[model samples]
Target: MIQQGDAIPSVAVKLVNKSGVIDGDSATIFGDGRVILFTVPGAFTPTCHNNHLPGYVSAGEALRTKGVNRIICMTVNDHHVVSAWADASEALGVVEFIADGNATLTKALGLDKDMSGGGMGTRAIRSALVIKDGIVEAVFTEDQPGQVTSSGAPAIVEFLESMPS
Candidate 1:
């Protein structure tokens, strides 16, 4: 998996917005800015729906106040699923959702998680990356699925608080 200070792969990701769809890459979307890229194994899953997504949504402003330019929630699901989940969660404006349908970026970063036995197929593991200017500043990943500790919004908030102002 990618580590702190590692330059994030400039992998292509389909960014879905209410306005329309746009082709984006990490180096560009997160370019010249501080960003929080949080990933969930699957959208609408119990833990992700109840905690991960909402946590970031609730902490969006605080994270930006601390210098984060964009906060994104991503998964290996398609755009339709992501859109519906975002709508359901009311996370439209607060957090952008990226559809990595093929787990392109996830695999590129070496964070792919196999859930095929569980019938979900390949997905990104639960992880978060604090990237500044396209370089990872901090990385947090949970060892077990359905557990959001180091990668939760509050944890990211604390991580930001610990950074030099």
Candidate 2:
């Protein structure tokens, strides 16, 4: 898996917004400023829906207060599903949702967790990445799937606060 100080991959994907969708590369997404990007295995899953994304959504303003340029939520879901999930949860205004449908970015980062036995197929491990000026500043990946600790939003914010300014 990717670690702190490693540069992000050049995988391209689409961001789904209420108004429309924007195509972007991971590097370009974090180019202008610092970004806190979190990934879950899939969209609308129990842990993600009930806890992961909500934690980030609630911490949106606080993350921005700490100089985070964007709060992004990524999943191996299609654009329409991602859009519907964000809209249904009322998370459209708080978070920018990205559809990594092809798993190109996930594989490049070595975060492709296997869940074929459980029928989940290949998915991303729960992880949060802090990027500044297009480079990774920190990474908080759960030791395994089904765990939420440093990968959650509050912990990520604290991690960012602990970094040198």
Candidate 3:
């Protein structure tokens, strides 16, 4: 797994946001300011919907006040599903839902995996990264399948607070 101070993969992908699709640089999108980028196995799944995303939304204000420029929730799902999920959670006002339909970003990050047993196909592991000026400041990744590890939003917030400001 990636770790603090690692240079994030300089990659780009097509992502769908509320504003529509965009060709975004993984680095630039997280550059210039502090960013919290999180990945989930799939969208609308039990843990992802009820736990993962909601926690981030609930922690949005605190994260921003701590210098987080953006909180991105990415999944190996399409635009429509991402849009609906964000809307249903009322998270459109708090988080940015990004569709990684082709796993382009996931693959580039070397976080792609086959989750066929769960019927999720290829997806990224549940993970979180704190980036500052395009450089990784921290990373929390699940140890293996079916584990949450230290990747939760609240954990990420705690990690950020522990950092030297």
Candidate 4:
């Protein structure tokens, strides 16, 4: 799995927004600032839609105040699904959504899980990463698929609060 000090992989991703979809590179997107990149198993899943994402939406301001230049929520779904989820969550302006349609980034970071048993096929494990200038500063991965313990927004806020200023 990716760890502190490892650089984000340079992979192509789709940036989905209300305007439309845009092709983007992971390295360029996360390379220049303090970023909070959180991943869900899949977009609009029960746990993800009800619990995980809402935390980040509510905590967006707190994270930004702590120097997060960007707040991103990524999933192993296509641009259309991600865009709809972003709209439903009402997080368009507050949280940016990225579509890892091919699970390229997930596999590259070693965070991919075979969710075929659940009929979801390959999916990203629930996790969060704090990166600065493209290098990982912290990694919080949930122990189980349904539980959001270490990778939740509150945990991230606490982690940032404990950082040396």
Model 3 segments beyond 4 Å from truth?
144-149
Model 4 clash pairs are: none
TM-score of each: 0.96, 0.94, 0.90, 0.97
Worst 10-residue lDDT window for candidate 2 reads: 11-20
Off by over 4 Å in 4: none
Tens-digit per-residue lDDT, 37-114, candidate 2: 899998999999999999998999999889998888889888888888888878877789889887888898888877
What digit string (tens of lDDT, one per residue) describes model 4 on residues 44-70?
899999998999999999999999988
Which tens-of-lDDT digit does each residue in 131-161 have in candidate 1?
A: 9998999989998878999999999999999
Compute the lDDT for candidate 2: 0.85
- The better candidate by lDDT, 2 or 4, is 4
Error of 4 at 154 (Å): 0.5
Give the lDDT of residue 59 in candidate 4.
95
For model 1, state the Cα shift of residue 111 in Å: 1.1
Better of 1 and 4 by TM-score: 4
How accurate locally, in lDDT, is each candidate?
0.89, 0.85, 0.81, 0.91
Total clashes, candidate 3? 0
Ranking by lDDT: 4, 1, 2, 3
C-alpha RMSD values across all candidates: 1.1, 1.3, 1.8, 0.9
